[model samples]
Target: MKVCSVSVDLDPISCYYGIHGLGEPPAPLAHVVLQRALPRFAEIFQRRGIHATFFVVGSDLASDPSGRATLTDLAKSGHELGNHTHHHRYDFARLSAEEIEREVADAHQVIAQAQGSPPIGFRAPGYDMSARVLRVLESQGYQYDSSLFSSWPYYFAKAGVMGVMSLLGRRSHSVLGDPRALTAPVDPYRPGSGPFRRGQSSLVELPIAVSPFLRLPVIGNWLLVAPARVRTRLLESVRSRSFFNLELHGADLLDADQDGIPTQLISKQHDLRIPLKDKQRAFEAMLDRIAQDYRFAPLREVATDVQREGKLRAGGQNL
Candidate 1:
């Protein structure tokens, strides 16, 4: 059976500020992603009767009471929660092994408290996973890590943006991780000593969705902005993958005008200018298109099935 796992990275607005080289965001916007956008996600998913996995940053849950309430409420409604690290640091892959463990453990604790169950899955911040990061996850007994993104287009585009920012004398906090990751397998696999290679590790790596040949990212950040016809084409292209891990962010549901986001961010975050309703409509349409061919499940469930199966088919041969 074909599986499609939908997961949202609930990184707050401050992270975006750092990415755009805009230092600290206004104090009031700290919890905007959770307070304003999270409910929108819950509403849309509820309407379709879909259960998704939400990767939560531990610091958000620790600092925001209302956000914690909403997250726990979603958990009660049957959605799965995964650890997104405590700080959402874009430099997570470069941190020391001890630091990586602390980051994972801290988020694990808060998420377990909020959802009343320890998260069995994790997605690293900025889709940056290292051998050190994987070691931490294995030590904590995580079933899977869904952080390897093998889209060369996405990697190059990010590099170009960061390069421009540097030339213009703006310092973005985001890091460009090991280029070898751009060549990792696009499907789920047991990573080797390095997170990018296939091996016999216990923790599986469920990569984010990408198109076949060109490897265009089939994620929310791009799909939400693409024309309807383009979105349909991309969705059709990825239909061959047995497991489609579609990743979305809280910003996908935020509208600059309605949400009171400042112009500084709105200018850099073009998707924020697109009305929230339009993005929502496009998202629902994409889901409807995929629903015909795939069964939707949380990443944790998909990971469990993959673990039990032992071997996975990549290019007509089991790996």
Candidate 2:
């Protein structure tokens, strides 16, 4: 049977501040996501009877009681809460091995404390992963990593945007990871000794879903606001893959007015500009199509299913 996985990265507003190069605003922005957006997400998933995965940032959990409680509630409701590094650093790929280890371990403890168990899955901050990063995960006995996004179109476009941001004198808090990541597998694999190449390793890699043609990302960050025609074309390309992963961010469900998000922030973020109701409808439409076409499950369960298939890690122990 064809399989699908849906997951979200619950990075708080501070991460966005870094991404936009806003550089620590004088006053903190209320985590619009924690207060409203996440509740909306919980409602949608609960109504749909979907047990999705959520990658949680460590420090974010430490920030507020409400956010922590919300995340704990998600775990209690049967959704998988996975690891996102402690600081949500955009340059995770550039961090030293010791720092990487600290990041993963710190987040693991924080999440485990909130959820009553340590996470088996991880997604790197900013979708950045490298051989060193995987080694850190392996050391911690993580079962899977879903940060490898091998999409040239997405990568190059990001580079271009960052370049323009630099030229315009805005300090984009993001960085372009190794260009080699674009060559990573379009499907899940057991990352061997190499970063992208398949091989024997205790840790598995479930890359972010990308359209095989032109390597466009098939995730909510792009599709939730993409025109129907564009989304339709992208969906067609991804249907051919055996395992499809749809990744979303906590910011996807926030609105400028209802969520009290700054108008300037909304203006700069393309996806956030869409009306919340419209975005919900678009997401539901896509989810309807996905449910019709494939059997869906939480990402950790999906990875377990993949490992059970005996397709990856030849002669390599099942992850």
Candidate 3:
């Protein structure tokens, strides 16, 4: 069956601040994504009877009891808890090998404690994955890594944003990862020895959902903000792919007014500017539409199925 694995990256508000070159957020806002927005995602998935994957930053779980509790509950509810690194540094792919291992191991330890087992899936911070990072995952015995985003449109747009921020004297924390990643396979493949190429490593690289030709992202933030007609077109573009790795962030469900998000953040984060109700409606509509063509499963399950069937080769082609 065609698979649509919806995964949420539970990035804290601080990550966004860093991305925009804004300094640390207020103390109370530290856990806002986990405390306020997490439950909203859980409710939405629960209503739809979907068990999704949640990629978590380890420090959030270690520092906040509420975050730990929420994830523990989600794990019990059959959701897969995956590691999203410890500090969520956007420069993760550029870090030293030791630092990368520390980030992955620290997150793995804490997520295991919270979820009762080691997380089999991993997503690098800022969607930046490197050979060094891949080596760390291999050492940790990870089943899959979903951090490779191979959309040129997304990459160029990010580069443009960071460039503007730089010219404006605001150094955004986001990185313009390996340009070669823009040419990586769109489907699931076992990464070879490097970042974007197919390899013999046991780890499967599930690139984020992108259109076949234009390679535009079909992610939550874009889908929610895009005009209905455009959104439908984007969705249709990826309808034939056997795997739909729909990625979302905790901020997608956050409301600027109702969630008490500060003007500073709401002004920069486009999706946060939309009302929570509207985002919720758009997300549900997207899910319902996708359900017609694919069955929803957590990334762990999809990875496992790929492994057992031995369908994916080094070139990401199905045998």
Candidate 4:
């Protein structure tokens, strides 16, 4: 079966601020994503019958009533709310193990409070995680982690972006992760011993999708900015894989003009510069294409199914 998993990193504008290396965005940008764009994302998934997994920053729910309410509504409407850490720390790789544990625990507590259940999955901020991070997840009883993006093309592009920003005097707060990720497996595997090498940690790693041919990404930010021909070809190539683990962000749907975001800030984001209507059409079309060719499931569900497949293969059953 061709399985598909859709997810959104519901990072607040503060997270984006870190990416842009800016001090802080206007207050409106903070609430706009959770309070404004979330419902719209939910509606799109609902209409298309796609069960999206939302990786929410735990700290975002700490004191905001409206934000918590909107997240709670997502749970009520059957979306799987996963943890994206408490602070959305960009330097998650550099944090001490104790701090990492605290980050995960704090986020877990807050998310569990809102959804009435602890999230079973996690995605590291900035797609940077380490062995210590995976250990904390195992200790916390998480079923899976989806932070390893091993596409060489994606890595080079990210490096170039940060490099350009550095030269332009706009030092981005985003950290380039472990270079070894470029060699990690592109499919689901266990991350017990290390994030890059397969081990016995009991936690599955569902890497984001990349084209098998050239490692072109199938992520939302790339999709929104990529040309139509490139997007179509990449999607088709990814569909050839057994699992299509598509990742997105709340900012992917927000428009610079209507969202009240700082022009300077959003200008750095390629996708946000596109007209909101055009973004919607492109996104919907992409989803429609996936819905036609693959069965859309949340990461939690897809992870479970992948686990089963692994077990069956170990049992000598041909997949």
TM-score of each: 0.97, 0.94, 0.97, 0.94
Error of 1 at 233 (Å): 1.0
What would the TM-score be for candidate 4 when compared with the true structure? 0.94
What is the lDDT of every predicted structure here? 0.90, 0.82, 0.89, 0.84
lDDT of 4 by residue, 96-170 (tens): 999999999999999998887889999999899898898899999999899998888878888999999899898
lDDT of 3: 0.89
| Pairs that collide, model 3 | 192-199
Clash count of each predicted structure: 0, 0, 1, 1
- How well is each residue in 202-305 modelled by candidate 1, as lDDT tens digits? 88888899999899999998998888889889999998878888999988999888889999999998899898888988888888888998878898887877
Work out candidate 2's RMSD over C-alphas. Answer: 2.7
Question: Following a full C-alpha superposition, what root-mean-square deviation does model 4 have from the true structure?
Answer: 2.3
- Decreasing lDDT order of the candidates: 1, 3, 4, 2
Between candidates 1 and 2, the lDDT winner: 1
- For model 3, the superposed segments whose C-alpha errors exceed 4 Å read 312-319
Worst 10 residues of 1 by lDDT: 310-319
lDDT winner: 1
Candidate 2 structure lDDT: 0.82
Model 2 lDDT, residue 21, Cα:
78
